[model samples]
Target: MDLDEARKLWHPEPGWLNTASYGLPAEPTWTALQEALAQWRVGRNAIELWNESAERSRAAFARLVGVPAGDVAIGSTVSQLLAPVAAALPPGARVVVPEVEFISNLFPWLAQAERGVEVRTVPLEKLVDAIDDGTDLVAFSLVQSADGRIAPYDEIVAAARAHGALVSVDATQGCGWLPFDARRADAVVVGAYKWLTAPRGVALGYLAPGLRDRMRPDAAGWFAGGDPNGSYYGPPLRLADDARRFDISPAWFCYVGAAPALELVAEIGVPAIRDHDVALANRFLDGLGRPPGESAIVTVDVPGAEEKLERAGVRAAVRAGRVRASFHVYSSEEDVDLALNALAG
Candidate 1:
């Protein structure tokens, strides 16, 4: 796939570099949404249609993250997706998390304290070292949101598994721009609004077979069952055996957008996407006279750089006392040039 396909999807006026905060949706997402609205206006709202759309989205996410569709769950947000996971763990279980993490990954595990579980927060460097035989869960972010630090997550995952601890990852910053295996973690939670280029209000989750078999479906609902159809008319509660048991009903419009967004990403493939983003990010770092980093995020420690870049029509953000410029598949060398010149100014 060429940049033309991505360019035609969303055109930010010029010098828009804030894609890490929120991605621009493709034209197909809009068209699909309008079609859904039209169907609703005509009183043709069908539950079957919504189910089919959600299935399409689940399949796309599974393919993207290298998991089976049966292992994927749908939710409105990453926090919402993770709440059930927190509730399902045994009481008094020791949970290890990083001191620096996006709150979505932090709060839920911390909230488990009310259930008598112990939550330990350590520095990201010591996260894996903190895990032991007594630890039941390890929750962390694959990419640090503030400073763009990509953690050595595979080592952590292996350590957790070796210690018999379940690992849950908040992959919001790293999911679409990079390739990751869902099977590596017990659970992987993601919000689609950022790197995935879908709208807000939809998140994708993956539960590994081991975790899926062990945890109870604490938040099971009408749609969170083996046959939502048979469950609707049969027993009061008959949940599915797979990850679908954790699936919640999502906003239909979000699914309309997500299906196309994920399909496009799948067509482009994450390997190619990672290479493209890394190249652009390295170019941006080099342009700023900084060393190359591993991921698509480049953070410069220049004073007042965020405001200066903004005034120069280059979009960037100040996070943790550094100017963070996040590159994506849609970013071009021209965008980096504009940003470098603006930084120099």
Candidate 2:
């Protein structure tokens, strides 16, 4: 594929570079949004419209990650899907997670401590070590948002399974930029804004077959009862048999806005996108001539170094630093060079 043409379709705006974070998909997603909005204006019930969009979105996500559509659920955020998984854990069972996981992955399990569940923080290197027979659940991010370290997911999943533990992955940072093997995870959750080039307030969750029924829906609503017919006359509600069990009617406009973005990604292929990102990251790394934190990212070696960086106004100043580029299909070698040159100065 022509990189430039492909980029044009993948990026919505020119010169608004995004190296510190990933950019959403551009043209195709915008088109999908318009179509979804038009459909919504016809006075369709919000729940019905969301569920219909959810079906299409799920199918697209399943195809991207190589899973069955039945395993996918539309969610508003990663935390929303994870809340149920945390709620369903056996009382007093230990949940293991990396020490530096994003807040979305950390707080939900910590909340479970009130229910007698034990939350254990293990170093990234010791995540596998923390998973033993006593561990009932293990959760981690596929890519650490701070340093951008991609975890060895297959190994982690295998270790968790050996200990009779279920595994959940937060793919928010990695989903659109990296290729994921869904069969290796018990469940995977992602927010579309970061890498999929979609609008915020849109996300997807995938529950392995048979595992959907195991999760207690923390945000269960009438729609989750599986009656798209608008009839709520069912016995004390059971979560839907499919991943829809996690569905809460999300904002229809946001869902519509996200569709084109994901479709653009689908067209380009994730592996191609991953290759593009890795290449760009390599360029940034090589230009720094050492690990990040020295020339780029403005990080320092201090106690709570990461926390200090955030407090120092990193996100706002991200574009002014040596590492001022963003990750997107349209990001260019020239952009990488410019970031490197700024850091070299």
Number of the predicted model whose lDDT against the real structure is largest = 1
Which regions of candidate 1 fall more than 4 Å away from where they truly are? 2-6
lDDT of 1 by residue, 1-345 (tens): 665576667656667777778887777777888888888889995657766878898998899889999989998899988888888889998998888788898888788888898988899989878889999999988888887788778999999989989899999998888888778898999998888888898899998887777777777777887787767665667888888898887788788888888888887788787888889889988887778988887778876788788888888777778888887877788888888888788
Candidate 2 backbone clash number: 10
lDDT against the true structure, per candidate, is 0.84, 0.71
Q: After superposition, how far is residue 13 of candidate 2 from its true place, in Å?
A: 5.6
TM-scores vs. true structure, each candidate: 0.94, 0.83
Backbone clash tally (model 1):
1
Q: Against the correct fold, how does model 1 do in TM-score?
A: 0.94
Query: Considering summed lDDT, which 10 consecutive residues are worst modelled in model 1?
Result: 3-12
Clash number for every model?
A: 1, 10
Supply the TM-score for candidate 2: 0.83
Candidate 2 lDDT, 151-248, residue by residue in tens: 88888999998888998999887888788797789889988887777788888988887666677777777667666455366566666778877788
How does residue 141 of candidate 1 score in lDDT?
A: 86
**How well does candidate 2 score on lDDT at residue 7?**
83
